[model samples]
Target: MTAKPARDPRDYSWLPADIQAFIARTEAAYPADAVTFSIQQQRAFYDRLCADFDPPHPPGVTTEDLTLAGVPCRRYTPTAPRSGVTAIYFHGGGFVVGGLHSHDAICAELAEGAQVVLIAVDYRLAPEHTHPAAYDDCAAVVDSVPGAKVLIGDSAGGTLAAAVSATRGETAQIAGQVLIYAALGGDPSLPSYTRHAFAPMLTRADVEFYGTVRYAGGVAPVGDVTATPLAADSYEGLPPTAIFSAEADPIASDSVEYAARLAEAGVPVEMTEEPGLVHGYLRARHMSEGARASFRRITSALAALAAQAVAQ
Candidate 1:
């Protein structure tokens, strides 16, 4: 179970100094069991964190809240005109955390970077909303969004984004997908799972804990291939995918295996590994150099997709 090659840590040196300070303060505040903390506590912590980041305006982007099939969604539209390519993004927080405010910065940046409308879905959380609830909420938004679409999310949100895209299959009007540091299910023996089991941010135990809370009262459906998009029964016609994982994270291997499966299914897929970066880097964009670099990659990928749309 040898680890795979990943981007070097030095690449993140470009991150703002204030962001680095914010990350240090945050680490001292919240650690591995962040989900176990009360919602109010988490919200307070997040609010402060967001306060620390430089408020980059979403140039050419307008935001609005709308209801689709009774589900509420916040949409970020880039000022640029295009062929109606929109992205429905979900935030990562182990299904038990995260919301509109928690991921506001990344969503805004992605919307502006990719030059596409970004619809951030606020799916119901777990221990209250439970399994299938969050995923369904996101899928419904995908089905409801007008015109072509791209599905994107980080961590648990990434899992849900992939699940929704996979479940909708080929005919669903989706354009592509971008999953960042997602936690796809995989065999425990995988290299990253064992080698980086206790990686700084995410751990196998943390994953197990999230799953337990998410499926607490449900039928506890067996971990089907579809439930775990990486292990999906099929990936044909599901659009190209970009998966980003960090070398210092435990779940990096799962994303690798998922990309391979997609490739085998003939799906166009690109996988990037960031070295010395831990899980949840996307949310810490203000602090971690790896996080900022990853965001840049996200913007570049989305912009590339926008360019291809133009050529077509």
Candidate 2:
């Protein structure tokens, strides 16, 4: 099948006014070439970027910084009683940047929205640490979280969530997965990759660069399900999934294709594309109506998944 055509610059004009303003403000603070900076600089900048758009922490929520099975994590607990469900989140930074602190606000909002406990893993990063390290860290935390759990992540973290869900399908531990604009395994030649290769925030080249650094040691096999879940032989028996894709993201096709594969595998899946939004739109939830709507959908999906786990 032919890939979707490239998006026209004019298409951005159709976005909500608040989204447009958010993008403008973001561009002014972070230039396109910012990705070329050193890893240290990138981390600092990313942390600042996340902080700049951070939504207010919901009232009646408590946060705790702790480690799960040797992996550092930050937990967000809503004031309301827990439903015995937990969401293990991996932060998006292409497996190179981002940490528990970077995604603190997002996790808090999600916890408040879903009324479930949220644990954001601060997985090991690349260049210093390699492939299996980050994957291993995330898996460790996932394994530690007992009982019903949902895997949730954005971008690189999304990849980890999918990988863990597929690799551990036999355990029946995960009830569902929520991937937000995930960088799931997809061919760079796909339509979305070509069309949004140069889109704002994340680009095709940026994705490749991050992958290179993430697997610098090359210890893990390229076909390994833990490294690339999309390359898995089968997605059968996996839990229900919700995938959110940004219409203007280079990896948009990743989510689209993944959802299709899951459906074919007899796994229930829902895929939603947010128009006029770029990669990392989760950070704009407080500012963009479109983002807020998407956030609500995500929370609703998580809530449903939690209920399903309780009923079983």
Candidate 3:
């Protein structure tokens, strides 16, 4: 008898049932061709989709919106906040849509879990403020803080977290970083891009689109470490990092490569890939077991990093 052929990992059948349900629920509220629409329309679509997944913010977390170094930010303070440490979080909307409100629950939960103050950045988006603009905003917030910081972000925000890690880690005395499915300047032609190009939530095409919008005149700056951390000549001196990636996402390889580079630079790093998950799984935390586990890892990592800061 002939042996059954190996299943194609690219097929949706390879995704766990819970993840599939998450995809269905997410896409149900978000237009499948949302990327094809006007930026304003796309933002509205994304806002509605995020609202549909709303879970209550962790109890006993107090928040306030303020401007740090002229950049809008939301600060979450836990009931039992730890002194001498703070986590700066950047929300992910491909750097065009997400803002403080979009990630309110996530920030609150993270602050409560880590028992530290967490500041969620509301950086300027693209086509209006490109590339270094957002980086500068995030960095200004980092500079505004008095001591070492915990830099954290997902997707585009993850890219910013790393950029900040390289640019401000030393001056800010950055304690650590926690990146979720970050698009750390990896090769787009890699196998993950080809295999998961059409993966749920985010596609390779979407990644390319965001890149174009992120830069000025669709041209990326040459050798700008603040724009793309991976483009930096050196990864040395970066703070300890924890990266969580989705196995089925086209950008998963970015996390892998970033971790390897960090280790090579002698920077302590930990990377975890959640099998059968896709990009933007952070919003699926309440729906998928894999996502929930990843979220827990994120919170735990933040707590550990804050502890490290306190120890020093």
**The candidate that achieves the highest TM-score relative to the unseen native structure:** 3
Task: Give the alpha carbon lDDT tens digit for every residue of 146-223 in model 1.
Answer: 777778888988888788877885556777888898877776788877677655556777777776777756344675
lDDT of all the models against the reference? 0.74, 0.84, 0.88
Model 2: weakest 10-residue lDDT segment is 6-15
Off by over 4 Å in 3: 1-10
Model 3: which residue pairs collide? none
Clashing pairs in 2: none
User: For residues 169-243, what per-residue lDDT tens digits would candidate 2 score against the true structure?
Assistant: 548388889999998778787799887777777788888787677776644366787887788888899998989
Query: What TM-score quantifies how close candidate 1 is to the native fold?
Result: 0.86
User: In candidate 3, what are the lDDT values of residues 1-312, reduced to their tens digit?
Assistant: 999986664577778899999989988888767889999988888889878887888878888989999999999999999899889999898888979878888889889988989999999998788878899999999999887699999999999999988988788888999999998878787778887888878888888888788887897777777877778888888899999999888999999988999999999999999888889898888889989998989999999999998899
- Count: clashes, candidate 3: 0
- Give the RMSD in angstroms, all C-alphas superposed, for model 1: 4.8
Clashing pairs in 1: 60-79
